[model samples]
Target: MVDLFGHAGPAQVLERAARSGRLPHAWMLAGPPGIGKATLGYRFGRWLLAGGAEGGLPAGSAPLHLDPGHPTFRRILAGAHADLRALRPNTGEGGVKRVIRVEDSRDAIRFLAMTPAEGGWRFVLVDGAELMRPEAANALLKTLEEPPPRAVLVLTTAAPDRLLPTIRSRVRRLDLAPLAPADLDPLLMRLLPSLSTTERATLGRIAEGSAGQAVALAEGEGLAMQALVDQVLADLAGRRHWHPVAEAVAAKRDGSGFATFMALLRGALSAAVRQAARGQGAAPWLEGRALAEWSTLWDRLGQLAAETDVLSLDRKQAVLTALLWLTPPRR
Candidate 1:
């Protein structure tokens, strides 16, 4: 289990809810990806299943701190727990499919309908629930609408806005915020032992409070890509070479590459905005109207990113589109 950071408020809120025996059937752990939304959900499940209230805040075994030796921990970790069912994206031989299909949701429904195998609370954790297709969401909605007795369902989503309004209404929202760079430093060091101090700091900045995002960025050559973005941005006056950077980003479109690119792009614009407002940064020259252009540029980048995600727009085209817009033909 990953060490959770900077989310004690949500944990206490959940603890109170669970201890009161009034835990909601559905909880939407809404937050940006790589934050501890899913981790907190699992911890809650562990706490509940371990009969946490029976122990009452014992030092070594707080509800969130179930020792690895505990039966519940072992059961969940081994996927041998009778009452817990977690559905994540299915990566099979065909390819890595992003959407969780309806069939799996039906299986969860069936699982919920059955009596708790051990006569305790049942839990259903849907990681990245936003990945559910329409049919899958509808199927899960049916279960959500009429949940089984002694059952708790948690749907963790990076994009809760994409969830059905009805689904959102049915569940209590527990939003998780990203951790600060200082809070994330220890975890980043553990995860990337070989990373230099400078590289680690860069990852923390790019992570924007998401330990998960930091790990992904560190492993995904984010520094290299960020270097490219910085170079392109610095060349704003010259408009020198975009082909190489564009091609490089285009090549990285498959997995975390696009995300790193977007993070870098957005971070660059955000820095400019910050620099303008605060007179910070070595190049805070974008003082007034020039600084104002950052927001417009940010919006343009965001629109392109949305189109790329929703429409599956060609990666190269998306990269080129962003580049052209960033360095538009000076009118």
Candidate 2:
């Protein structure tokens, strides 16, 4: 169970709406990818369908939970529920990225038009709804305009602005912020119980509230590269020779290593900035005017990252540019 942390404020609002019988026809759930936008959508959907854990957890229990053995849970997971419709990426005859085609999305209309099989609420969930093409999105507009009674639509997106403005206007928006480290730690425990405590802590920091991305980063040797980045920053601060850092990234001419290096470096910089802003102050070199220097360094690194990908520029040189931005060599 992916506990929806840092999201209770919005959830409370939604609960109030549901209890008052004024739940909106459409809801836009927007947040960073991998941070449980879709997870929360399903949770909310289950709540609307009254799919709580069987036998219940006593009064004032969490609504987001559903007993896995429950019929509603099984049907929702199996996509066999009469009152629920789900739209996501699925291949359509040689299509790429398994885009949500208009063909698949047309079912929402038919699903909403009919009465609920359970004589209760009906819902349509579009995960990563931003991935839908123009046609698929247009097809959804009519339902948004005149949804049937007891009908609910949930659209989840990492990038809400990519959606049509008309589509954005009709639904109430629920904004999900990233989970704090404290909040994300326990979730990592549940999801990756096999991981050692150190490993989970490392991933919890890098995952930054994203359970899916944490798994990806863990598998991709992100931690190993982050270690290297830490060494490089330590060398820079100690005024030690840093040529080895350059050589390490240069060894991978494929550019992926450089990208990883930049990502870790950017994370460190952002951390330092945040620490400074909290009145704890950053490292000596990162305090006061030096803070401005780090800011400039971040913006420059961002530009180089953009240009390297866009123009296919030399990655080694781009990394070196970042190192120089950190601390130039002796003249």
Candidate 3:
């Protein structure tokens, strides 16, 4: 395992599965994106291929390094390994197809029919299992109903609710929670040694327990995002017009900075909600009518986060519009 930050629960489940032969034939690893679910799945596959031995597979055995150079590793990475198969969407036109077609699931049948390359266990990993179309999911259900001997199927999903009930019922479900600050702090320090203590704390606080997100914050990306969010909030607090800020943000529609900006808005909104929960005198940065407006904006932000296509909107524009709507009219 790469020890990618967070995923303590998933790591424990895999370890327990290795110790006990009672490991389920299929596992559903569900969690938010950038949370190390795929890394854990790969680690589990490596462990199984290596016969539970540590430090890579034995010589002459199928490569289990998770490195692209290894034969089996390449197969898994390229989605072409004979014994190991990954059920995912086609990489054709239309940008990843957005859904796993029935054909993709059907491919698993061929992989399952073959014997293990190393005469041990065959592994199938479905990254984003929730993307499976109805027909594809039905095809997958057949395999799950009667799994092959010495075979393991792992499904990783950011949205489990999108999956069929039948599929969810058959597999052993592993829920992964966000990583604690203690677990994330060390990783952030290791990844960004140059970060100041204040910066690190800010990132950790905004990460909301996601190590991947924390790293983004520590790397300065998140700060830039926070600045944009702060600008909008500050303008609203001053009773200033928001069109200029909104237009400025909308201009960078597809930039990476926009994504970070969205993350910052989410983090700030979360902080505001926590402050509101604590009642007055919670956050030193908030006071007077600013606190009242922030509390109201918190509810609106929560609703916006739940929107189906929130990600598709211009990052700055979306957040700015929300701020503008929440801002009090100038006298």
Q: How close is candidate 2 to the true structure, as a TM-score?
A: 0.85
- Off-target runs (Cα >4 Å) in candidate 1 are 56-63, 91-97, 238-263, 274-285, 301-331
Please list the C-alpha lDDT of all candidates, in the order they appear. 0.78, 0.76, 0.69
| Native-to-model Cα distance after best TM-score fit, residue 318 in candidate 2, in Å | 2.6
* Ranked by lDDT, top first: 1, 2, 3
lDDT leader:
1
User: Which is better, 1 or 3, measured by TM-score?
Assistant: 1
**TM-scores for every candidate against the unseen true structure:** 0.81, 0.85, 0.73
lDDT, residue 320, model 3: 62
Q: List ranges where model 2 is wrong by over 4 Å.
A: 1-6, 51-60, 90-99, 237-243, 250-255, 285-289, 328-331
- Once model 2 is optimally superposed onto the true structure by TM-score, how far is the C-alpha of residue 251 displaced, in angstroms? 5.3
Q: For this target, which candidate reaches the highest TM-score against the unseen true structure?
A: 2
Q: Considering only N, C-alpha and C atoms within 3 Å, which residue pairs clash in candidate 1? A: 179-209
N/CA/C clash count, model 1: 1
Better of 1 and 3 by lDDT: 1
Q: Write the per-residue lDDT of candidate 1 for residues 43-91, one digit (tens) a residue.
A: 8888778877455434443336666778888888888999999998776
